[model samples]
Target: MESDYQSLFQVRLANYDDIPAIMNITREAFVKYQQMSGVEKLAALEESYNDVKKDIDTKVVLLALSDGEPVGSVRVEVFPDKTAYLSRFAVKVTSQNNGIGKSIMNLVDKIMVKKGVTQIQLHTGSKITSLIRFYYGRGFYIDSTDKSRGYVRALLIKEYQKKDC
Candidate 1:
């Protein structure tokens, strides 16, 4: 089925071939942010080939494609108890502010609802105020801040109480 954001792209589970292009988009976007902050030295930190490989092994990465070109992506790992952990949400810089992020997230919400998930959760750093605010705008609320995967980050959650089918 086509996502409501069909004009923007199709959001789907990532296939192996999409990883290289997904990594390229991620590197380009993050490196651009690094450059704009005059922290060009941090540009090298955007290397995501290995991270992409790991996410693929974990079966968590989702890719968004526009005309067969990689334009956006996010990853989420589902636990047995109907909660999911999301990470690495991104849209190619050129595609930002066009509702693609919201669209991709809405797609995930719907899918998780169907999967019987009761909530979705993720973490963002205090340094990324904009990202936190964005998640808030999407109905996520700050739950807490704690050591997540060795990094101090804010925990945010969005509960899903799907209507009966």
Candidate 2:
């Protein structure tokens, strides 16, 4: 069952040693995103090791591993206003559709909720219907769209309910 496959993945906070795996996964995943979105290049693809290192040092960077092999990664920066920005969410091409992405996202939700983040926002190509649907299924809605990057990028927002303590 899917649950069994999902159980194979373990999500944890990333450290300095994870930078290479993180960079590899991001490049491999975003190269596919570029092809799918018909864009020649993406900022994700241009990120250097230093950029990833900076994130690991300053933000909530998570790495998902399967049987001790890196399979996915995501980064989130929680701000002073109780809002969080999610970026570079990518699962390995071989690991896609196996519940790894969902697992990582569910962990993000739990982490954000614990941090009292009421709203989480991310941007993806607006025209990518499958991705849009995925986010929709995860409780995100299109807050707006912008073409500043030469493509219609949708700003998706997900708001969490404050828990009664």
Expressed as tens digits, the lDDT of each residue in 1-165 for candidate 1 is: 757556646788887788888787777766654544434344235556777887888846788877777888888888999899987777899888777788889888877887888999987664466777789998999889875334456789999997976
Clashes of 2: 0
* Minimal lDDT window, size 10, model 2: 1-10
Using TM-score, give the best candidate's number: 2
Candidate 1 — what's its lDDT? 0.76
Q: Pairs clashing in candidate 1? A: none
Per-residue lDDT, model 2, residue 130, is: 79
- CA RMSD per model (angstroms): 4.6, 3.0
lDDT of 2 by residue, 51-157 (tens): 99999988999999998899999999999999999999999999998888898999999999999999999999998887898899899999999988878899999
